[model samples]
Target: MRCLTIAGLLFLCYVTQGVKHFRLGRGKGGNLGAPGGYSGEKLPPAQWFKQRLDHSSPSDLRTWKQRYFVNDSFYDFNKQGPVFLMIGGEGPADPRWMVKGAWIDYAKKFNALCINLEHRYYGESHPTEDISVKNLQYLSSYQALADLANFITAMNNKYKLQRSVRWIAFGGSYPGSLAAWLRLKYPHLVYAAVSSSGPLLAKVNFMEYYEVVVDALREKTGGEDCVTELKSAHNQITAMMQTHPHIVEKEFRVCKPFEGASENDIKNFYNSIADDFADLVQYNEDNRISADVKYKNLTINTVCNMLTSPGSEPAYKKLAAFNSIILEKSNQTCLDYSYDNMIKELRNMSWGSEGARQWMYQTCTEFGFYQTSSGEIEVFGNQFNLDFFIQQCEDVFGKKYNADFVQASAEWTNSNYGALDIATTRVVFVHGSVDPWHALGITKTQDNDAPAIYIKGTAHCANMYPRSENDSSDLIEARVEIEQYLAGWLGLP
Candidate 1:
């Protein structure tokens, strides 16, 4: 049996409750949406869910805040339009994604009541006081699903439309996984669901993430040359780390020099690179329309443009330019790409850390969604192996958390939740070819109602983004199919 150390557990708990917020970006605030940007649209009152500390235990009750955004502008309960529920994810529940999301467009057309519910442990929802491991016993998907079950009951009871109104679920990324799981777990609540780019599978190691990124970059450049050049550049950087470490500090412009840093710091510097394309692929949208891109068009196409376009700078310098782009996007000034800072960012939730503590806990305990790289395909591989994550558990939460315990947790999660053998109905698993997460999503289906729509050249939850004129025909079709599925399930004419 594996165990967690009390010291690490106490440290995590203390960090959760008392970590001070330090200024990082220009606005001195964390980025919620785009670079240095928030919805600016004020969030509504957060409703409380009479939640249980542990769904399994059910004895410990807590008033968990469920920060939900509602738009009833086009509601027609008289017409009996279904309720469109947008399940929130790993980050704070920003209503702008719902207000400006493609799901809302469907809601307006369907004359439905649009609702965006924040996930448990995210936004203002706190099942426990401090994010200590002991307190985090209730922070699993099962607990979150139970909270949704309660929310459904509450919403129905208040509205007095328990049997009269239909419910449809929609979400992107992690919430996308929740949306689908909700349907599978409680089909009675969610009549139908649209899981956009949801990573439904659980695994200890996910090296294919960077492989997909490289493949996407390859397609954009019309050849393997782009990936080749990047791999070569990253190889040189890694070699330089051992031979002439001073050059890395000068080249990367990192806040702290890595002249005498630990292995974690080296891994962090590599992670900084991996996160660049990882984010772009995860949130990419239509490349044709210039303005619809929320992330300043940080697409694979853009990366290829930067890498391929000729400059007088050397190859290493060009690679450094790519790193610069990610640093700028991070919105943190004077940020040392160090492991300590990474741990700080992960632990401190008050500092606008995007629910990382909560998510990392879940990842470490339940879903090991760690995105690593392979030496054969990616630029920096073996540097971010599974042991790196195991060490992370040792350093951050507790040294007692062994690989065996983590691996067992992942297996148990898959067994309880049905990762591969998930039996469900009326779920539209919409994913893109370019999305790295989609590799773990529901790829095939035996049921006619449960279909997986694969879009080409798109990335992440682009199909779920607010539709634009320049939106690809594939995305348009996927959205249409979702509407049709919901319509069929809800018995709408």
Candidate 2:
């Protein structure tokens, strides 16, 4: 996930049709006025709450308005039903989450209020004027948990529920980790949590991520030949970079020539190509009805078919041809893997920069989830390594964010969060076997209190999406099991 962000491969486009209407306070909500609305449901208007800037310091009185959405359509106000809080991730928090997702289904079943809280420095929840390294000190997971605590307390008082109402937190991917941590750090506030495809461990050199990608390729249909050809293609490209650099540039349709490119540029170029496969396997069939339709056809099986097609062309040529297909679909004129360009883009503190700069800062300070290809058995070559990513931290943020600092930061994160050894109860950790991020998540049952759901053939965050008719039986059963756990926790039959 971090690798895709670093390589600039993650597209930030959400396709929503029709007009979006916004209301200030909790009002009677209707349909989103869109044809593809989720069961003809509408997302509640955006709301704001003043949150503390520095939750650790008692003297600091500074505050900022954080964005959130509330949908109490299914709330059993007289009975004071449970509250389902969906934690936003590295990107902006879509209000649609308050109306859709499997959590909304659960909210309907339990007659609970659905609230979506935007993470600080993401979406409309800007805590500081700029994302400078000094300003980003308040953007850690510790502060985020504090935000959730304060928000929950404020909501409880606003609704006059006090301690009677139970709060169930939900999140996927990076937010998934935050959900679990929220329950661990503030168990009194969060009764139970659903952490789907959450990476619990903080690792510096995550070579296993790529190993899982190789494993997925080898296990899919026609994937055996695809894996062999992929390895050979990467070797060929590595050799050509050393001798015939011009040919490599021409074949890959690089935006800029590599005649005077820096070593980091070459490494980034390799990473951009490898990230294609990683992106495919990571998302796979996790596409829900609300997801971007552009990436629906791009899957593990689709790429494997292209790589294993019958032809006299060399494997490297076939690999380049596959990249062209991606370039066309993404509407990218040519590949731009310049290290300088990436640093320049990330240095911008404007809101238009989205959460890329903020997320990169988090990686440098807290989690070093660098997906390096150092393993010899990986289909992708060894051009990109831990040092490559660590250097970017120093280059983009500052000199103090070096390798030693990163190592200490990761160690501190694991130590503070308890990593996989977290002593929490009523937290269900759900993961897909094909999801590479599951390598760091808890897959086995830790105890009766902290059980894990390891879905066999699903991809990243598959259990969090809305139920689809085309879903595998394994996924349907997993959702049913999750419902059972939530029902028991909520004191329902």
- Index of the highest-TM-score prediction: 2
Clash count of each predicted structure: 1, 0
**Stretches of candidate 2 above 4 Å error?**
2-40, 289-294, 376-378
Off by over 4 Å in 1: 1-49, 286-295, 344-352, 375-378
Alpha carbon lDDT of residue 401, candidate 2? 96
Residue lDDT tens for model 1, 1-493: 0001000000011112122121110011111232112246554454555655566665655465556667777786566678988776665555455456566678877788877776776656666676776677777888878877878888888777748687888876667778889998998788888887777888778777777877788765688767767777788887888898788778777777787788888876776666665655554553222222344667677776776667665556777777766555544344366777667666553524435566667777887766776533446656777787777765666766678877888899888778857788788888788777777788666578688888877876666655667677877888787777777777765
Candidate 1 structure, TM-score to reference: 0.87
Q: What does the lDDT come to for candidate 1? A: 0.65
**What lDDT is reached at residue 36 by model 2?**
23
Model 2 residue 76 CA deviation (Å) reads: 1.7
Candidate 2 residue pairs that clash: none
Instruction: Summing lDDT over every window of 10 consecutive residues in candidate 2, give the lowest-scoring window.
Output: 19-28
- For candidate 2, write residues 347-420 as lDDT tens digits: 78777665667777888888888888886444787888889989889888999999999999999999998999
Clashes in predicted model 2 = 0
